[model samples]
Target chain A: MRPYLYIAKVRMLSALAYRFDVLSSIVIQCLAVIASCFFWIAAYGNQQAALGVTRDQMLTYTVMSSTLACLLTMNVENRIAASVQKGSVALDLLKPVNIFGIYLWEDIGSVAIAFLQNAVPLLLIGALFIVAPVPASAAHFLLFILSAAFSYMINWLIAALFGMWSFRIVRIFPLLCMKGHMIRLLSGSVIPLWFFPQWLQTVLSFLPFRYIYQLPLSVYIGILSPRETAAQMGIQFIWILLLGCLFFEIKKGVTRHLLVQGG
Target chain B: MPLIKVNDLVKEYTVIKKGKGLKGALKSLLHKEKEILRAVNHISFSIQHGEIVGYIGPNGAGKSTTVKMLSGILSPTSGEILIDGLSPQKDRKRVVQNLGVVFGQRSQLNWDLRLGESFELLKRIYRIDDRQYQENLAMMDAILEIHKFIHTPVRQLSLGQRMRGDLAAAMLHSPQVLFLDEPTIGLDVDGKQAIRKFVKEINRLKQTTVILTTHDLGDIQELCSRLIIISEGTIVEDGSLSDLIDRIAPYRILHVELYEEAELPIHPLAEKIRQDGTAAVYRFDKKKVTAAQLIEDLSCFCKMKDFRLEEARIEDIIRAAYHKKEKLEGV
Candidate 1:
């Protein structure tokens, strides 16, 4: 456990050392936030009661979801797939720690860094320039944090599953890109699912993406009642458990093949 | 028991064979022809404790594959390996805890961390105690002078410096077995010598068993007492350098620098291998005739300005073996 923690600590330090990349990411996020703010404000022009929320709430939702997006989406899958292709994953296998554990810890480290460098500043800027809604109460804020953590874990597990496919296939970037586009469209990050057609909204209720992007944002903005918030959190937990089990199964198969094929 | 034992070790890979041009590519995608490559054939060897054994071979000779399997990074298709009575396939964590591996072509350290920071991270990863960590660091700094560039990030360090840092990082846990795959590749004379010296010192002081794989003959001559030569996924020769030279090429060369141009001597015991304007080379089987007898016979044919005897080097012997194998394979 300590060794795994050390892996995370080193990753965080590495993230700090590469300040240029951090700065670039912050800049990109700032541009994205400003662009979306204008796009949403213009689209909502003079419509006070669009999607059952005021213009102010819609602006808050856009900014809030964008900030949450910074925390949830990670590049763990790309990095893992690259390592597999380059054969450097062999060195990781030689380590005493478990491969899945190492990646999980590294994801945690990146999340901590992303929250500090990308999320906090974007949220602050939104609060000043846009009418971002504050948390309804302390309890709602606490529940939102729990939901966000679950969302992070679920996202990592999904990425891990896709990454494990690289061991057997040569190219997975196409599938990964499609996954990103689908999540953005269905999870209400691009546009709130409330604005989608009735059939589409019902379809998204069956998928887990909404739990990651929409649930946490809606919870923070007090869009859901207490019972609804608890139900959504429960659904998020179910996704984590399902994704985790699947990840472990794939990980076992991949590691076994790695040993047999001498990757 | 031997510290490391391998019996009938084998590794096979299923590789997709791709064709050239658009037609071939389309055909390959439709048919998907696959071939099984036997990277490591059945090989058997055992090493006692504290032995610095040199594992040498040409490219694509299963050297890296064997090392990877032994270090638990890869599993054998069929065979048995016991590292201190533990099977890496069955007890990967325990076996890896006792083993340290370094590949010269790739680094295990994080490029963003300074040298000292990388060491510290490894220390925590390996769970080395404070006393052991400090003592090992001090000893490593003495041997490799790591303290000089300990603050520099790995990406900023030169190749030589990175190799030194890598060697130290691998030894952070004081592993009993160290597997170095081409540790001195692309290094200068000084860097190679420093690495050779470090391997010797660690082997001597801690009795750490070393399995070194390299292309440099100088490293083999200076560091290894025994050699294992592998070609085409199998061990061709395994013994001391002298024994290998004696068995594979039991001959000596007699170079005679002549005062003037002259015809080389034709003798039943010696062959005139090469000749220049004022120099001649005669190769003779030492078993058939002595150096003195060859020189005496050569003198009868020409006036010799100077003469010297040269024994077969490891490079020559290994090259002969490689060519012989190539002929047998008809490749």
Candidate 2:
């Protein structure tokens, strides 16, 4: 608990060191989301609706997903992989604590700070420009929270799994970039799943990548009913639990190799 | 009880050999070759409670590998290691509580935070009680003079200051066994002496057993009583430092200054390493050719102005051991 708090304090302080990086990240995200909001509003200037989504609902989805993207720009994989390359991970391994726990707690601490100090402020600015959807109802709010929890697990596992690849190569960044881009593009992080062609949307629905972006956005936009949202959240949890196990196993193997043949 | 025990510890490595330059880099992409390296060959040793032992080796002689295994950072390949009677690999978190380690090339302190903050963080990680923490801090500050820069971040601390800070950090929890890997490296004469003094003091005061691995022969010569020298992944010699030097390769070197320029001495028991106008260096076998006998022969043969007898230094003895090891390996 002490180390966790200590590390978290450092994690929080690190963001404050670079004020411009935080400000710009928030500003760019807000402006881009607003621009997209206007583009959608103008497109549906006179039409009643498009594909069961109203102009207001689409605007709501736009604001929330944009905010969520900024909120969840963890880049945990990049951090861990960079540590691997720099040999800093060796220092962490020497401590009398669980390496996995330390990384996980630090991840939570750092990302939590990023979201509060960067993403929340950006979301507020987006709300000033457009009507961000509040949750449709109390029941839907709980469902959305469940979905977001699942969403976090999926992102964390994918990032950790890629990070463990440092044993194989010095730089996992380029590969992480390519893989993340593919996931973002398919999961509708840069766009909305509602805009995708029907078949593509259906295929994306069956993939776990949706848990990272589309499902959270969909629930916020009132796209799914109570039962449907529950099912989606369940799927997200199943994937999280399953991948979490694999992530730990790979980490164990990678740690062993590192300790034996240290850089 | 033995504070540290290792049995049949082994570590094998596969090294990727890549050529130099652009052509070699490209060729490597198509056909990559690997070389097998056995770092720590099958070996076993145990340190009893409160024993300060020196682990010595030539470069690439598996010193660090063995330290890593004993400290619980690395898992042995085909053996068992028990520090305080628990397998480090099986129960790393628990085993780590019983051990403290310092690496010369690395510091565990936070780079951007004050030394106080770093110590506080360690206090939390090790979960030291408040009363004990304060007592230890006071004792460390008195011995290490850590108070001067307790507020300074680790990056701003001098190398000597940082070494002391690292020592304090490793000892914050007051573990039973301390593993120091080149703790005195890259320090000035004062810094080295200060660290050596502190390590010795703690071993005496706290009865903290220390297994130190160092290339600095001076540290070994000053601090350690028991010595273990390994080369080519095998433990070539293990015993008291003086005993190893005595049993094998005990030779005294003699330097004689002639009253006038003279030719080198020719003898079966001694070999002339070099000779100038007035002085000549002769390496003599103390077992067969005594220094007294060499002196008698030199006095009778030439008009000797002066002569000096030198005892074998640990560096020279260790060098001989390493070279002898290489010869045996036919490397």
Candidate 3:
């Protein structure tokens, strides 16, 4: 446990070493959030409500979802792919710590730093210009935070499972690009599920992407009742368990692949 | 019992067989061809408690693969590796706790962090006690002189400094077995001396078992008590350096300059391989005839102006070992 924490701490310090990269990413995410807010404003022009959502709720949804998208982004797959290609993954496996634990803590360190450098500033800037609604209750805000935590775990597990593919296929840029597009279109980061047709919504309910953004952002903006938030949180946990099992299975294959191929 | 033992270890890779031409590429895309490459064939060796064994081989000879398997970075396809009575594949964590590995071409330290910071992270990762950690640092600092640039970022350090840092980092945990793949590679004479001295110091003080894979024969001559030469996924030769030299290159060249042009002295054990004017060179087996006895005999026949003896060089011995099959084929 102490070792993993130290890994995270070292990773955080390393991430902070590139001040210019961090600052530029923060600026880019802020621009993304601001652009989404304007797009929502134009889409909802002269309408008090559309698709069972009030204008203010829609504005909050757009801002929160975009900010969450920026905050919850996990690129563990890129790290895994780069390490495998560089042959440094051997050094990683040499350590006594669990490989997945190292990646998890490293990603946590990066996300934690990004939250401080990007999410806080972006949300503050968004609050000043956007017509965002406050949470329906204190419980809703707390539950939204909880839901976002679950969202991060689900996102990380999915990214880790995807990263395991790198052990088999060294070049994963195309796969990564496809994953990004899928998340953007299906995870409700760029577009809310409320705007999608009922049939698409039914299809999405069976998938895991919506839980990444829509479920958490809806709770944050007071769009979901307390009971529905609880149910959705349950679904998030289920996804975590499912993805966790799949990650371990893929990890076994990765270990065997590395052993045979001498990565 | 030996501290490290490997038994008939094997690792095989299935590589896609890509064709050369554009048409062959298209054909391969439809029905892919695969070939099995055995990187490490049935090779086995054991090392005792404190020994510096130089594992040497040419490129693509499976040196790194063996090191990787020993360090628990890769599992053997079939066979057993026991590090201090524990299997690295079965008990990786426990085995890794006592293992340290360093790759000359790759660093384990974080590029963004200071050298000290990286050491601290390793300290935590290995769970070295405060006192032991300080003692290890002091020991490493004394030998490696890492304190000179301990605060510098890893990327900012020169190659020598970075190599020192890497050596120190690998030792911070005080691992029992150290695996160094090309430790002295790409280093200046001074840097190489520093590494050699450090390796000697740790082995003396801590009795650490070091398995080093290097193409640098200087490292082998200066440090390793035993040599293991692998070629084409098999151990071609394994013995003391002198024994290997004797087996592959048995004779020493004795250059003798006589006072006048005369018939070279003929001895039963010595052969005059080269003669130019008054200069004659005799090749004699050290085991059969000592250089002093041969010289005394030669002086009785001719007045010698000058004479010098040269032993077989390690480079020639190693090169001969690498091409042993070729030499046999020529014979």
Candidate 4:
């Protein structure tokens, strides 16, 4: 545990080392959020409400979900794939500490830094200009925070599980790109699930992607009732457990076929 | 019992046979042809505590593969490795706590952080107590002198400095077994000497068993008490340096400068291979003929101005050993 904490600490320091890269990413995320808010505003054109929600609610959802997207995205897949390609994964496996735990802590460290650098600024910009709605009450806000934590875990586990494929596949970048596009389209980060067709909505509800962005953002906007939020949070926990198990299963296969690329 | 024991270890890699061009790529996608390459082929050896053994072989001879298997980075296809009576594959975390590995071509240090920070991370990872950590640091510093660049970022340090830092990092936990895969590679004379000295001191003080793979014969001559030479994924020779030389290169060269050129009389155990002006060269088998007896027999006929005995060079000896296996396999 101490080792894991130190790994996270070292990761955090390294993530913060590149000031220009951090600043540029923050700018890009800010543009993405503002563009998303404007897109929602244009879609809602002169209408007080659509899909059982007002324009303000839709705007709030867009801002919060986009911000969450920026916060929850973890690059562990790319990191792992690159390490595998370069054969540095052997060095990582030499440590006594768990390799998966190292990836998780490194993600935590980078995400913690990203939160300070990207999410806070984007949220402040959203609040100042778009006038996004606050949570309905303190309880809803607490639930949103809890759901967001689960969202991070789910997103990270998905990335890590996908990263395990690098052990078997030579070209992983295209697959990773496909995963990103799928998550963006399905997780309701770009377009809220409410706007999707009924069949797509049902499909998403059955999938874990919705828990990554839509569920937490919905809680933040106070759209879900108390009972619904409880049920959804339970579903989020289930997704975490399921994904966690899948990750370990894939990890077992990965170790069995582990090929250190270069000496 | 030996601190480390390996029995008939083997590692095989499955390489996909892909042809050239887009047609081959498409064909490979549909019908993959797989080839199994046995990198470490049923090789077996053991090392006792505090022994600095050189695990040497030519490139792609499975030296790195063997090290990886021993360190639990790669699972062996068959056979068993016991580090202090524990299998690294079955008990990786426990076994790794007592083992340290260093690859000269790749570094384990975090390039983003200062060297000290990397050491700190290793300390926590290994759960070394503060007292032990401090003592080890002192020992490493005394030998490696890593403090000169401890505060420098790993990327900023020179290759020599980084190697020193890496050595210190691996030692921070005071591991009992150390695996160094070309630790002195790509280093200057001073850097190589520093690493060699460090290995010697660590083994002497801590009784840490070291298995090193290196192409540099100087390292073998200075550090390793025993040599394990692998060729074509098999042990070609394993013994002391002198013993190996004697086996692969069985004779010594004697250069004698006589007062005048003459037909050199040779004993049954010695062969006169070269004669130029007043100088003559005789190759003699050490097992059968002593240099003194050969010199006495030759000197009685002609007053020898000067004479010298030369053993075979280690490079030639190793090359012969490596080729000896290839010739046998060819047959």
lDDT by candidate, in order shown: 0.85, 0.80, 0.86, 0.88
Clashing pairs in 3: none
In order, what fnat does every candidate score? Answer: 0.77, 0.58, 0.77, 0.85
lDDT of 1 by residue, B1-331 (tens): 9999999999999888999999989999899989999989999999999999999888889998899889887889999999999999789889998888889999998898899998988888778899999999999999999988999989999999999999999988999999999999999999999999999999988999999999998998998888988898999878898777667767778888999998786889988888998898888777899988888877888899998887766676777665553211101
Better of 3 and 4 by lDDT: 4
- State the lDDT of candidate 2 residue by residue for B122-232, as single tens digits: 888888899989988887787788999998878889999999999988887888888898999999999998889888888987899999998898898899989888888
Superior candidate under TM-score, 1 versus 2:
1
Off-target runs (Cα >4 Å) in candidate 2 are A1-6, A38-48, A259-263, B19-24, B254-305, B325-331
- Tell me how many residue pairs clash in candidate 2: 0
Comparing 1 and 3 on DockQ, the stronger one: 3
What DockQ values do the models have? 0.57, 0.49, 0.68, 0.86
Q: lDDT tens digits, residues A111-229, model 3? A: 78877888778778778877544676788889888989989998998888888888888888799889889988998888888789999999999999999898888888787777887
Evaluated at residue A143, the lDDT of candidate 4 is 87
Query: What is each model's TM-score for chain A?
Result: 0.94, 0.91, 0.94, 0.96
**Tens digit of lDDT per residue, candidate 4, span A192-239?**
888899998988888999999889988888888889989989999999
- Evaluate residue B82 in candidate 1 and report its C-alpha lDDT on the 0 to 100 scale: 95
Candidate 4 stretches with Cα past 4 Å from truth are B274-277, B325-331
Q: DockQ score of candidate 4?
A: 0.86
**Residue-level error in angstroms, candidate 4, position A38:** 1.3
Q: Chain B TM-score for each model?
A: 0.88, 0.84, 0.96, 0.94
Per-residue CA lDDT of candidate 3, range B52-129, in tens?
A: 999998999999999988988787889999999999877878899999888888899899999999999999989999
- Over the stretch A98-215, how does candidate 1's per-residue lDDT look in tens digits? 8778887887787788889998989888888877558767988898888888888877777888888777775778988988898888888878888899999998888988987888
The RMSD (Cα, Å) of candidate 3 is 1.9
